[model samples]
Each structure stands twice: as structure tokens, then as C-alpha cells.
Target: MAGFDDITKKAQSFLQDGKVQDALKSEKAEDVSDKVFDGVADAVKKVTGGKYDDKIDKARDEADKRIGNE
Candidate 1:
């Protein structure tokens, strides 16, 4: 599942970067967090041809939790 791991890592990076940008733009943290999670989920779904919906949803949930904690 190296490919999946790579995709997850990349998604996380994208979320983190978006968070930073959002913060700079004075966006609410909660809103930014949601946007990041949704964006990642959509990207994962597109990349996997919609074959890994459960995994993507789980990843997005976990990422949201992690981002919220930060």
C-alpha cells in the first residue's frame, strides 16, 4: 500500500499548506479545517477512481481530528 501511503502524505501536505494560507487570510480555523478535509477527500476519490471511498472518508476524518487538535 505504498501508493496509498504516498497519496495520504501528499494530501496531508496539501491540507497543511491550505491551513497556513487560510490562517494568513484571516479565515476561521474551523472553516479552513473543513475545507482541507473535503479537498483531500475529493482528491483521493478522483485519484483512486472512486474505489476507496471508505478509506478516503476515514483518512479525511482522521486528518480533521488531527488538524483540529493542532
Candidate 2:
């Protein structure tokens, strides 16, 4: 299981480096939040074998909402 701190750090790096925009572009901006969320979710799922699927999904939804609001 990946630690929450590690996940957060990775996300912070993405934001700090402006990689989030790249990701959003790659995802065609369908839903910036969903794309970003799914990218992280998929990575976590791959590493943990779906152990955090639900949490990731909810996180993604929240992220999507936040992005939409921004």
C-alpha cells in the first residue's frame, strides 16, 4: 500500500511543475478534474492491485468538482 504522504507529494510535484496542465491536455480537457484524478487513481490501482479503488474514485470526483470550480 502506498502511503498517503507519498501520494500527496507526487501530486504536489505535478502541480508545482505545471505537469497537471500537460495531463489535462493529454486528456483533452474532457474533465480536468476527472483526468487528473483518474491518472492518479490508475497509478495507485496499478501499484496496490485495486485496494484503493473506491477511495481513488471518490478522490477523483472531488478533484473533478474542484477543477470545474476553478
Candidate 3:
């Protein structure tokens, strides 16, 4: 789970980008966020050989919810 934390932290940092925040408030917020999160998770999957794919995806999904709620 340590790997999960590490990746999620990185993902969170990515989420902090101004572009991401802007994207979250766009007309297509859900679609944009989903694409971005899926892209990030896909990259993590490749880098970690899918070992942490589940964790990455789970974190991305939860983050998506938070973004949507906000």
C-alpha cells in the first residue's frame, strides 16, 4: 500500500495543477477529469508494469469523486 500512497501523492500533486483545476470547472468537467485521471493511471500502469494499476485506478476514481463534488 506504500506504493499506492506514493502514486496517489503524485497524482494529487498533478491534480493541483492550474490546468486541472480549470478543467474541473469546465462545461465538460466530468469527461475532462475522467480523461485526465485515466491517462495518469494508464501511465502509472505502464511504469509499474501494472503491479499498482488497481491502486492507481482506485485513487484516481476517488479523486474524481472529490473533484466532481467540488
Best by lDDT: 3
Q: Which ten residues in a row have the lowest lDDT in candidate 3?
A: 61-70
lDDT by residue (tens digit), candidate 1, 1-70: 9999999998888767965656644536657888878998998899999999998899888777654434
**Which regions of candidate 3 are displaced past 4 Å?**
1-27
Candidate 1 collision pairs: none
Residue 2 alpha-carbon offset, candidate 3, angstroms: 33
TM-scores, each model vs. reference: 0.54, 0.47, 0.57
Rank candidates, TM-score, best first: 3, 1, 2
In model 2, state the lDDT of residue 18.
64
Better of 2 and 3 by TM-score: 3
Report the Cα lDDT for residue 34, model 1.
85
Over 4 Å off, model 2? 1-30
lDDT score, candidate 3, position 13 = 99
lDDT per residue for candidate 2 within 1-70, as digits (tens), equals 5699899999888776766755554545656556567788899889989898888788777667545433
Find the candidate with the highest TM-score and give its number: 3
lDDT of 3 by residue, 1-70 (tens): 9999999999999999999877776668877777888898898899999898779988998888866433
lDDT of each: 0.77, 0.71, 0.82
